[model samples]
Target: GLAERKKVTHVAMESTGVYWKPVYNLLEAEPIEVLVVNAQHIKAVPGRKTDVKDAEWIADLLRHGLLKGSYIPHRAQRELRELVRYRR
Candidate 1:
């Protein structure tokens, strides 16, 4: 993994509603911090429009500490949320 390979300690991701959950779950347990920014904010920035370029744009913004991360509850809290929703 890049985290182990490069001794990376931080990662950034743009939130995409519920879709980001599984990815978040996978990364949360790792020895790295996960940042989830609003997807709309990242998409609003002008840049060389392309699949790869978009990622680069985000990386640049994140690298500069220009992006803000959204709060993500711990796994236990998420599971509790799901349980309550299911019982509703």
Candidate 2:
């Protein structure tokens, strides 16, 4: 959209266990900020999930800084972590 034509300033993703790695990799550089919230933290009215409402819920939380962000390792640290973890 025209309104978002510029580079994205921040990104928000819901953490589903360890399933967020690929997403983090994709957005690590472009966006100046990245926020990964835990799925357990979001609460909605009792009903079936809808794409529109789900996006709204996540957006609302993100706007208010109410969503907790996941820890992202520094680049050097991340490389070291992967090396150690793989050696095990």
Candidate 3:
């Protein structure tokens, strides 16, 4: 994986609806720490609004440990919730 090749220790991404789930699930199995940050928090910071710029901004903040990750339940809990939802 690119992360292993680059020796990346942490990854941070904006939380946008249900889109971050699959990616998070994949990264959860990796050795690196994954942070799902609120988009609003990123927007709150004054910066240029471009995809490239936003990525760099997020990376910079993550590198400095300035970003806060949202609470994500464990895989078992998440799967149980999904099953319940499907049953409902």
Note each model's CA RMSD in angstroms. Answer: 1.8, 3.3, 1.4
Off by over 4 Å in 3: none
User: Would you list the C-alpha lDDT of every candidate in the order shown?
Assistant: 0.84, 0.74, 0.92
- Write out the backbone clash pairs for model 3: none
Task: Give the winner by lDDT.
Answer: 3
Using TM-score as the measure, name the better of candidate 2 and candidate 3. 3
**Tens digit per residue, CA lDDT, model 3, 1-88:** 7689899899999999999999999999888999999999998767577989999999999989899999999999999999999999
What order do you get sorting by TM-score, best first? 3, 1, 2
Q: After superposition, how far is residue 36 of candidate 1 from its true place, in Å?
A: 0.6
Candidate 2 residue-wise lDDT at 77: 89
- lDDT tens digits by residue: candidate 1, 22-64: 8888888778978989988888866567868877887898889
Off by over 4 Å in 2: 1-7, 43-45, 48-52
- Sorting all predicted structures by lDDT, with the top scorer first, yields 3, 1, 2
